[model samples]
Target: MGFFDRWRGREQRASIEDPRVPISSPNIITFLGLDAISASGETVTIDSAMGVPAVWAAVNFMSGTLAGLPLHVYRRTDEGRERVKGGLATILHDAVNDETSSFEWRKHCFDQAFTGGRAYSFIERSAGRKVTNLWPLDPTKTVVKRESGRKFYQYKDGSRTHRYDAAEIIDIPFMLKSDMLQHRSPILANKDIIGLAQAVTKYGAKFFQNGGVPPFVIEGPFQSPGAMTRAAEDLSAAVQKAAKDNRLALSLPAGHTLKQIGVDPEKSQLVELQRFIIEQIARIYSLPPTFLQDLTHGTFSNTEQQDLHFVKHTLKRWVEQFEQELNLKLFGRGNTRQYCEANVDGLLRGDFKTRMEGNARAIQTGQLTPNEARAMDNRKAMPNGDDLLIQGATVPLGTQPVMPVPANDNDEPKADAA
Candidate 1:
């Protein structure tokens, strides 16, 4: 390999897409779904907990966030695996890190290329090789030390079968394929004169899926189940209280507020009770608008962070004030977190209309999906009436029907595969 050829090989590897690799199904589904949903939710790529695709859902938690980048890699028997992987990764890693392609964008591509981080199915035709930007979960690096008797180690890729530990060429089911193993399932994972340790193999699988470079532990997912549940529950309760608290915060008239009609305002906590009431009254009687700028009013980082209680209290205070002054009903909580209707409608001073107009323009300009357009229509009570079967996409629970979404005639894309 001459210096110039090597240099050209490196230079040839920009963010250019490899023509050889076939797009995996997982990759297609994620990117398309994200495009559809983003239009519907009016959400950008950075929203937390917004799993545009299963890319976020694939990882247990925070690692999912980091995994949003497309990892360019070249794998195969071309005797250029290391060089190719390194070269491609260099351009891709930098491009992604610099946000030339946003985290969401790279993630979108990865899902398309690897079928949602399953397998790096790179098929070769002639004296060819396989390569991809994605890999099995483990992709873990390893060091083997032959301590006298046996030789083997486990692979860690964060799948059930990643538990294979052997000094020899161990085979395991790929996450994408989930059926066969590259080598063997239960390879050697013995310590000292040790034979096989199931736990050892499991550890290897974990190490591989997350990352094996330095081999670190990812404990964040432990809190995901609990924290997500609590956050949802807490937010639900707080919104319900916003009616009364909102009125009080805006100092609106209580007689017009809805909370006084069914429940006693005095029974609730001072801050919370006040806020909800204010919000409700403000809504009923049409009050002026307020804005929320994400301001860092303080200097120190060690101070108490904002949590459920603080949010609830703040909501309550705003609602309570509105009720005291406006004497109107406002702010009801249920599935969606909505602002006070009347306050929003009247006090918006045509801001709502203007925003809607802009949203419409965005839609007309090839930025919206049918589902999104339908949702927007439903919001304004302007019926589009296009509900075929169910709302939202399919949930993965092993067995379920996956009917293809009807594509538009005019805008229907010429699918590469079909």
Candidate 2:
């Protein structure tokens, strides 16, 4: 089936299986009924987990940042490495296919990886064995299996099953299980943390929904269980009415006394708990809390350090993983001359002054030519900027300059004497 047709079918299937619709199959019932339940009593599926601000922020931050990076293909030359511009390079750097831009393709793949634990793309090659396009496959519908000691990707498209060789698919898993073929989802693996966040948020919302009142029990003289229930219902109505009327106090029967049963949000430290959950989510993605918008402990200096930490530790790891996977699948294991890479120089573009200063230093130190540095900022090169330059005063450390000898003291007077 065509991509859009398959997507439309999937959407239709999802709509048909709406939660409100009843299902008879035990498996479907269980899947719809008991999504990953955490100790905090919150359902922690990918959709519910994403409802938590922290998880949403972390996933979007990582995936969007990665997708925004400049990806390129390069060839190793006798002089140095130079970027390859056509064919596969164009497919990677611009559009994976005529329908999708490179950014959207990468973002979709990474969004799957961050949320579902795995991302996959089918690489289409022409008769000449050159990559023509990359089509993303839904991880939920794609299964990886080993047959005859060879790995294969089986993708389910409606009623049809399409199979591809492992080399034809680019697979990135958040982490692998012991079986190697199966993967572990970050959301499923750390559902408890995400669940707690959801639970806390729900609690806060319900608390406010019911007039900012903590759950409480009524104590008084009651003749029967039914009477106690009636008294409780009356008090609940009174509380809601008071809140609706914007009253500061709630009236109760003379003999009945109300006592709070559950801990208040402040006492339970709900805000602190939320912040901690954000930190935990950040940890799951190897990101700093600052990236997730948890600035409780973010200082200017440490946040700057965190930016460096993110690039060096988290971003670089994923970049290398993606690069290696692309190189292997696109060029084959035997090919080494051509490779793919993510250029991270754009990450520093936000700090214009600092970036320009660093580029100037590189140019002055002969580490980069003027034109090469200009290319980083997407500026046109100067006519004479191709040459690598260094400070004129810079010389070998131990070398001494030849000094012109001073004329003898009497030599200046020789003309006058004549």
The candidate maximizing lDDT is 2
The regions of model 2 sitting more than 4 angstroms off are 1-35, 396-399, 402-418
CA lDDT of 388 in candidate 1?
A: 30
Q: For each candidate, what is the lDDT?
A: 0.32, 0.89
Q: How accurate is candidate 1 locally (lDDT)?
A: 0.32
How far in Å is the alpha carbon of 83 misplaced in model 1? 10
lDDT tens digits, residues 370-400, model 2?
Answer: 9999899899989999999888986788796
Q: Which residue pairs in candidate 2 have backbone atoms (N, alpha carbon, C) closer than 3 angstroms, thus clashing?
A: none
Over the full model, what C-alpha lDDT does candidate 2 score relative to the true structure? Answer: 0.89
lDDT per residue, candidate 1, 256-349, as tens digits?
2212122222343433532343333223212211211112232233122332232244333433342222121111223122121112222223
The C-alpha TM-scores of every prediction are: 0.17, 0.87
Q: After TM-score superposition, what is the CA distance of residue 107 in candidate 1 from its true location, in Å?
A: 4.2
